[model samples]
Target: MPGMVGRVPTSAAAVPGARSAHGTASAILGHPWGGTALGPPDSWDPAVRAVVDLVLSSPVPMALAYGDQLVLLYNDGYAELIGDRHPAAIGRPAAEVFVDVWHLPGVGDVLERTYRQGESVLEKEAVLPVDRRDGHAAEQATFTRGHSPVRDSAGRVVGVLTVAAQTTQVTNHLESLSDFAAALAGTLTLDDVARVALRYALDAFDADRVAFAVDDPGGWRTVRRVRGELLDEADERLPPLWRRVSGDSTAPLAVTARSGVPIFTPDGQPMREHAVDRHDQKVRALASVPLRSAVVRGGLAVGYHQAHPWSAAERALLSASAELVGQATERARRFETQHGTAQLLQRSMLPEHLPDLPRLRIAARYDPGVDGNAAGGDFYDAFLLPTGGLGVVLGDVAGHDVQAAARMGQVRAALRALALADPRPDAVLTGLDRLVASLGAEAGTHELFVTVVFGVIDADRRSITLASAGHPAPLLRRSAPGQPRAEYLDLPTGAPLGLGCRPRTATMAFAPGDTLLLFSDGVVERRQQSLSVGLARLADVVAEATSGDPRALCAVATAAVAGATEDDVAVLAVEYAVRPSRSAAMEMPAEPTAPSRVRHWMTEQLTEWQVPETIVGAAVLCTSELTTNALLHAGTAARVEIDLSAERLLVSVSDSGTRGTVTRAQTDTLSSRGRGLGLIEQLSDAWGTDPTVRGSTVWFEILLPAG
Candidate 1:
């Protein structure tokens, strides 16, 4: 009656009627539609009556719209499917009843074609607007719908019947699961796994909050995202958004993680007493699933701010997602273990620290390939020679594996031994060449080869002698008055180390305020780029650099060339400063009086060097704090070294203990044990820590007043 748009009879009693219908058809007959389009069901044509009986008898969701008005009629199943549109929609037109979505291509067009052309149509995964009945906005529903043309007794098309089966939940879950697996496949570390899994879970599960945790030896490492924002923690020892929960805690996440059991709370009121945060108190539903794996144990928790009925399908999806996360966590754990071991082995093969010499500032950097799980063969070293000159070498073996790392270690050890014995660049290379040849012969492989550049710097003569074994030429940056230039040395190249070939030495003037850069091929080798082009690019970048500081130059060069290198990179830079640094060292015992003794010795040394009293006092106080920290926390004997230059005074305290780098204690300001770092931060211009092979070094620099 609401959508009657065609000519209608004045009264149902005036027409010759068909047999009486029943059920929904009986209701249509009882309606006050005598003056409406269809008049009454008892007065309808026989064909329309028969189709109505067929549609009403079926249990599947089915509906029909008849005649030119396309007036709607549906069974009880379809009545429930349309949500609140129920009986009111029964006699209305399809377009008026489904006003929000009747014009969608998959709905009105398909029905129109079926009614007009008498064609039957089937659409898979058709999208329709649906009311969720949860006081929220309407959501999209997916269904597989079939439409058939209803014909009259005269063989003319009369109406269209549509049968729909909802598939929204299944389709959405399957797609989300597939994408989750693909995302997890690229994760390689615990942090990466946590990030990917948590974000995906929050989106896929439609939860207000999500958390991920992994069991570690120290405690449980946890990350949480609440309402699209990752929670921040104040602990500087852990990574960002990561908190360490005690393993024995009674928290839901911890309980599930330890017992490998899932905990589901549909009504979270009972658990509100144990809430840890305001969000937790407001949670109306939650699901915590254990990440069960042979290599790692963890948990994932999802929370909702409104009440939710834990449906069976939802539970099954949650379990499946947990399984995927567990597998990814295990894989990441194994990769991290292997990567850590490989990196440790590789670093152990290189020098622990560069030689801290006067008049020469040296710095080196090494990075593994993109796949860091495999070891690389790049190595570098700098040591004091017996002839009072400095020997620096950077080399690369031909392969990337354990054997390559071993050979690199052997070659590096032998080169240092050879250089200390002769101190001549050419002699060192010739000896290294023979050793490599013997190694190759023993391994029964002609592929074992190395490319290296060795240089000897004589500070007294202001000169450097260089020799090469099929390595890239070294770049020299000369900083003269109003004239700064950078160029590569044209040294004669020989065959790589495993081949028996003679090497020639080239001499060049290494003036003060000039820097020399030595590097492996990875630094200058890019895909689809020529070596000469890369070298020229490096020269231009070096010329544009403002300072001659070896550390700054190394940083710039590595940042410029190694941003996306597939191979390992190694860079070494040495700068001859304008004025040579004067340095001294003393070893102190790990006793209570170490700090006092360090203070007195430092004051005496600075006084002997004619350092200003204010600068000397500051240096002594900062050095004392660093030395105290080393002894208190490291519990090992410490080595104190001081380097005095025209612009700054640098002091370092080294110990052979395994304690990690120290940070200023945020909560323990009053405690004497942790105050040393805070004092160092306030008193020094720059201060930091470096992890060494066996221990660590804590150093600070104080800038001097203008001369």
Candidate 2:
């Protein structure tokens, strides 16, 4: 350990008494190789003797391959280097000894160059396949080997002398550090960094304990270890002896902290009192390395319950590894601070209030492509326009990031303001296009653009007029309960905003119980399928709706392709219906008690509507039956709405369950249920059940006789 690994000499074997006072290779001196092709040990030439003398007594791993056949000779250190192949390879030919590594690129070539050309060669980080092999174990080892020529007294090359140092420990250290850095790259807390560092270091070193301790809020905390196992960080406690050591400047941790060097106690004598996991047991070895950093100064400690040969190389590695823990801790602290600010900024840009309107139901959702949305471009909003119409807008600005998100916020805010002021679908879109074009016209701007489907629904006219600015067509669910399947509004659309183009209005009838689905491309676009396939899939979902509940419809449509997207998805589903106002509606929890609450609500609503007493009980009975079926069959949050008008009085129950069918159940007098639908049919002027994308709604309209 004290002497340097000396350079190779020009000759060996010719010297008398090539003594091997060693640990491992001493057995080679009396080996059975004297009867082999390498010849008798006493007959070796002077050049071979000189090199063998140089290697036999050396402290480091060294080997010499002499003569034209390159027979192998190694020292005690090199015997351990060959693993299980030591004594057998003492005087074997080099080619046979290196059979596994001979074919590797430049493996034997480097030695050949030194032996033939009389030049010296140095190879750092060389990988060789020659550790051990007795049919059970063989491992790859990394080495830094030096190859130099061995020549006779006349200066003619006689052999090749090689010096090798196994670098697998250093390689493992660097690899473990790389893994630790990757694990902590996204960490936003000190606890996460500390846990990863301690656990990974303990595993990498195969030690009993590994810890990073600092003077913190409570006390010095170390990652606890017991029987070669690491303690969970959540349940970790301060080491029982650490409090005593923290006050002593002569402690290993304190000494390393002040000196910035690794302090090692290979023998257990000095550490017996401070060792063990709160058990007062003795440890075989212990080490503490200082962490010098620009953030906070700390130290990394490692301990072993078994005797381990501590080396300077290992101490140097531990010192460098401690610095990485400091870097990760600082990085996590910075990330947490930056991420919080980004969330506040994003929330401030989106809509907080959605208009509550009668004769219309709206549901909108926005998801960022990335967590915390450093920047995302998808946006949606629902608001009351100035012209007494409901305006629903959904759009996606091109690109992603804080810059794109900022541009999206600007465009979204501007679109909402313009729509609330005008309400004409075409007029608002035209204004938005001009605004985007003008914003980009400013010199040296990257032409930012947006695609949008802006629409206004007028309950009075029972129509929804839409303008698509190079966006996907809105799916229109115009089919009545028993009519044909729903279809998309296949209207001619125009260019996106900032393209210096105008868009024309595309209007379609939005009847009572009809729905219009607006969404960003992220919903219907996928890497595995074409846009047309996604469009067809969307069409199928929309075509299945037979009710006008916005939330239910949104659930069904989004469920088809929710978590499979890479881009952020924004959906705005608007269903045109006589959605009762607060005064005309009452919502209760969907449970066993819902039927009674709903019956009571029906009694109150009918009284307010001044319905003739003769039919009030029948209406209440029908409402109870429908509400019970919705809660039991759909397992959805249910709502019942009653709208009383001059033409007819409408009572409807809707739920959010996406599966199940509305069927006419045959019943006898013995049954407790199944009579509700029959009663609804017998009692009302017109009653029908419509099954929407997510769930079904059953409504009965009693025509009011002309006065």
Candidate 3:
């Protein structure tokens, strides 16, 4: 519906500094509310009448006005422009045509300026396109023309003349050009892009609303919608077709693609009526604009408060915006794909194999950072000791990223070497410290250090010796037939390696029948909860899990804690038992006569035991070499033990003689002798003699899986 009109200057064309020459005429129109005139005007001026006649007779369809009134004019096209004007319109002011035009800044100014300047002057154009009666995106273009004056017959400018023509096509084309620019500028996210494109389409046709539908497996689905206040929240719940529409259009992206052209359906019929039975607030007239471009194959629908036809300009604008939307959607998809790849790669970097140790049912697990945002530096490892003890280690690097994880791997490898070389908890730490410090100075200035807990399980001693380098203490669970409880050990309390000169170390000895738990700080640190609280909770859960596997216990503990932790975690558990040595339980002889004899004997024994050929060879070579020394030096039949613990093989040789010197037999032409002890020293883990009541026990441990 047209709004009432008011007179005003054409501010856009006004000179830098100038007043209207026909100020009085403008004043008359401007003061309509002052109660000066009682009713409609009686007649029109001759000049105004001529302009009115031409507008009425032209096929373009037009409106005429003079001095703020719709002047009675020629008859032909005027009827359609005004809809249904009576004979009385001839004498009435043009203000009657509109409901509230006078209040609009630009429209009112143009009217006032023309009325004040009597010498006829052409007004700048105001174009609009109207669709046919049906709701569609196509259009009927219209152009409004006005005339002003420099002076009147009495040398005083007063009143103005105006004529309007419907030129929908050209106007719609220009509007489409502007929509292209707006679509590019107004969108950010995919959803936002869709809405902007839809809104542009509706604005092009001067429709009430715009809706976007995506094709789905089921059908067309309305995914996004935009509209005027009349249907404020109506589109929130879209029709099934609209929601699924995105999938139906094969070239939705192309149609929606920036360079893609949209398929036009000026008629609203293609769009199913949505919520037809719903309340008035939920229903509105609709128009559909189908897109089949390479980028956007989905269809877009424009809704109107009433059934309004589309104008050519409006259709053009809507199509241009659709193309803009298509490109945005493609960009969004690419971003999502890239992000998904990053997450997968990060997740695959963690270790896949876990170490198993004897006397200790060692099980290890790792969990990467949430959503795999970045690589985390949490790690856990277990290996067999020469003495059949389990070597367990857990640590966390300082940062979160692929670089930090790489550094963590380097440190882990260094520590693994140290574990095999020294076997002593404290010695391993010392070696790792040295390696970290000497890892090369040119690798960037950023310092790298790690908090670690390294410990060995002495299944024979029924205890564990653990050393810590500023790491969280391992959890200890002590249990009997019925008695059960868990306690946290105090960490060595020292600085992390690579930062201090002399790294401090503390070693702990696990009690008989106890379970040792090792973990990264992430396991016991939760946001909003103190570290101590988490530790206590973990202890409680482990105690409760006395009857379940330690791994299960860890899971329960993890679940018990809140899910807000931001760190990666790793855990290792080793349970101790008083059961006979793996060798003794398996009924292996405790003594071997000599290296040569032992080698020959093991070949047959291991073959029967189902050991792989390669492994049997390595085991025989290692055992024979160690046994030869005991026989030659100790002067006794050496007791041999081969226990297959989860991870390590514990070997011990005992003799009645006790001595510090382990000399290689003198050889020369009679060689093959001295090499026996040399082989033992080279192959076995840290070898030493421990005095027992029987004599001195010379023993060493080796890993079952040598690598």
Best by TM-score: 1
lDDT of each residue in 395-414, candidate 3, tens digit only: 88877777777777787878
Task: For residue 569, give model 1's deviation from the true position in Å.
Answer: 1.4
Q: TM-score for all predictions? A: 0.69, 0.52, 0.39
RMSD of each: 10.5, 16.6, 24.9
Candidate 3 worst ten-residue window by lDDT: 234-243
- The digit string of per-residue lDDT tens for model 1 on 494-522 reads 88887886899999999998899998888
Task: Rank by TM-score, highest first.
Answer: 1, 2, 3
Q: Give the Å error, residue 663, model 1.
A: 14
Candidate 1 vs candidate 3: the TM-score winner is: 1
Residue pairs that clash (backbone atoms under 3 angstroms), model 1:
none
Which regions of candidate 3 fall more than 4 Å away from where they truly are? Answer: 1-350, 356-360, 440-446, 480-483, 501-515, 545-547, 575-707
Candidate 1 structure, TM-score to reference: 0.69
State each model's CA lDDT, in order: 0.77, 0.66, 0.52
